[model samples]
Target: MKPAPASAPFAGPFALATLSAPDGPPFPALVTPDGRTVDLRTALGDPQLTTRHLLEDWPAVLPRLRSLAHDDTVERGTSAGLRVHAPVEPRQVFQSGANYRQHVIDLHVAHRAPGDDRPEDERRAEAAEIMDRRAREDLPYVFIGLPSALTGPYDEVVLPAWAEQPDWELELAAVIGRPAYRVGVAEALEHVAGYTIANDLTDRAGVFRRDMPQIGTDWLRGKNAPGFTPLGPWLVPAESVADPGALRLVLKLNGETMQDESTKDMIFDVARMVSYISRTARLLPGDLVLTGSPAGNGIHRGRLLRDGDVMDASITGLGTQRTRCVTEVTP
Candidate 1:
């Protein structure tokens, strides 16, 4: 007889790391009993700690790490947690455009397909659309930003006075734990260490990066504004994710649900994106892959963020990230 199928695992108990507000030092982490303020970075960086060591091994070390969280020796707190930051620092960031069919249709309509629909006009439109798409697809929409743009879990996002067209995109960010290149989709997940939520903040007003010639069209200026990216509350272990494609994702502005979606809406899917992106550039350990966002973006309505706007994005299993937007003159 075949061996009985193994039962699914559960982290009935676990420890999480968070910042020690009053202390402000990186050596020690403030633990949260209910998984609130746990710092995965501090936990993973500590050589003397066994929990961090097991995390490096993943499923093999999961059960034992779960047991350790129950120990009273771990420092615990109800609050005083520092604002969260993006879980990993990536060397390069690539974003997808119109990755959801609904978003594609919306973007197309918003721009009015650019021409009349007569038979001859239709043929020309089709050709142009194909050309435009091919040009963009020939290379994944790539952009670079500094780690300075990254904000912590509950950190406030500042909307610079120059960015009047601020918008929020709720996306799923994959954290690569292993370096990979030309890996098959079947084996791509192995290189992923975990997942988290990322808010790809954009400035529609076009003033954020006017110094650069290409500032208006793509992400360089729109995406690289200081405090434009708000990420994390948790860096969920991959094993805890039941099905990334099935998970429910959501974004809220000041307690108002704005973007509610499912990972199932993705056009390229996770593995295919990883496979395709890796073929051109080597994906190093700690790199981040930000999957595309779904529809309901504020840009569709010509509405942009102003001062005092609060935004939050959450993926199932990965937990929620909350950011408050504040506007101020550039220093």
Candidate 2:
């Protein structure tokens, strides 16, 4: 863990993480608000406990963790040099797509016909109107993501040689603490354990089927490559978030601010998105529900990722993820 930023990563007194020493196997840990870390396995006297175990019984385990947060006798370690892994091992990943109002509108305007000469404002207004209608009448568009795509916040993102337009989509992810099946919007959030950050990397060129245009987008090919999703640095408890709908998301490429927007721009809020998914699939503990990214993706900006490009992504109270892009080397 790096030094705690001047501004706290989360509002919670403590957050959860998975960390290990150099060459050590990852283990679940608790992170103090100031960035100090306490190995959960050691602190709780359970050498084999993982974050998944904690989440499986989050309701019962939370009270114990809360007590640990304030204990002064527990030995603590600095996160300065430890390796941080994705906070939890999720069995299922549900990803929402085109759920950010401004992001969808931006894509709509950017993907217009080549010869079209409509004014930028006119095109944007038209897209906005369409988005407004969708928000009022349509359900959220979501897709499944492979767990293999998960990677640590600071890991290297390998840009597959076959992908011509690799891009980034920084998003807010909800970590499920309770099993939710056919849950309604009113009670959807009650199943959430906490929130984290995820950068949903995409291969834009592979999004559509060229051979069969009518088949539509192929998410597996475009978004599920190994290490495509860089998730977490911390999982801040839901009670500490105050209002998940208002968090700010910011992504920087090589120190240049790229995507900077608020969760307020989302067409479907967290509760709605979670509830919508629960209607079809059971959301289990440790599962991740990734809300869509905000505007300013590479495609909209005309600057796709290149080898050595560094992306620093952050969501208010959830911590930041800094990933470096490296081109895959073929044998």
Candidate 3:
């Protein structure tokens, strides 16, 4: 792990931290709204408090812990000094595709066939109709990602030599706190533990299957490179985030803003994504369901990633992340 200079000013009532001392091992911590921390093990009355262990028992012990947040006797330190790690090791990570109407519109409108003569308004209308059909049919394109691809919020991303068009996708990730199966959309948000920011780095060139055109996208080869997912500096408890749909998400390359949009632009909300996924299989306590990204990606800007580039991402009330790009140095 390396130092990521960006710090998140958390406005949530309660938050979680998976971190260590400047030179120590990883452990779970309880973070306050003022950026102070108490070891979760001590607060939870257990000597062993791995992130997974805490999350697995959240549904049972949340009340006791919520009460502990008010105790002034617990030892506290500034969270700014701590070396934060990825909040949890998810058993499954589900990513949504084409869930942002404007993002899909940018992808479709930026590149048109030479002979095509469709007007901009007509093209946008067609795209809007497609999103409408998706919501009406309750069909969301969800894909699985390897847990091993995940890294801390500020970790270095090693761009492969073969990946010529590495891109950044800043998204809102919902952490599952309870076991859920076939849950209704009305009650799906209850299954969420908290919220965190994620930079879903991608290799644009490999998004489609050129050799096997009929197979569609090849996410494994294109998106799952090591350190492809740079996750949170903190986890704000679900209750603290009143409305996930109203939050603003942003991403910057170096110091220039690339993506700027609100969660309101999403074609399907967080509850719908969770409810749709649980219908096919059981959702575990630490599973991550990533809502899709908005527009202003590198492809739309006509500028892809390069060696030594730095990316900074933030979501309102969630947190901030800073990552530097480097070419993979070893085989």
Query: What C-alpha lDDT do the candidate models reach, one value each?
Result: 0.62, 0.91, 0.85
Tens-digit per-residue lDDT, 1-331, candidate 3: 4543434466555678788887888888877766677887776677766887877877776776676678898887766667778888899999998889899888777655457799988887888888899989989989988888888887888898888789999999999999889999999999999889888888988988778878888899878998899999778788878899999998999999999999999989999999999999799998899999999899889998888888889989877888899998866
Which lDDT tens digits does candidate 2 get at residues 71-130? Answer: 999889878778888998999999999888889888878777558899989998988887
Residue-level lDDT of model 1, residues 122-164, one tens digit each, is: 5545544753575456433444556567776677778877676
Global lDDT for candidate 1?
A: 0.62
TM-score, candidate 2, is 0.95
- How many backbone overlaps does candidate 3 show? 0
Model 2 pairs in collision: 1-79
Candidate 1 vs candidate 2: the lDDT winner is: 2
Using Cα atoms with residue i matched to residue i, what is each candidate's TM-score against the true structure?
Answer: 0.76, 0.95, 0.93
> Could you give the C-alpha RMSD of every candidate to the true structure, in order shown?
7.9, 2.0, 2.2
Q: Candidate 2: list runs displaced more than 4 Å.
A: 1-7, 113-126
Task: State in Å the error of residue 48, model 2.
Answer: 1.4
Which candidate wins on lDDT?
2
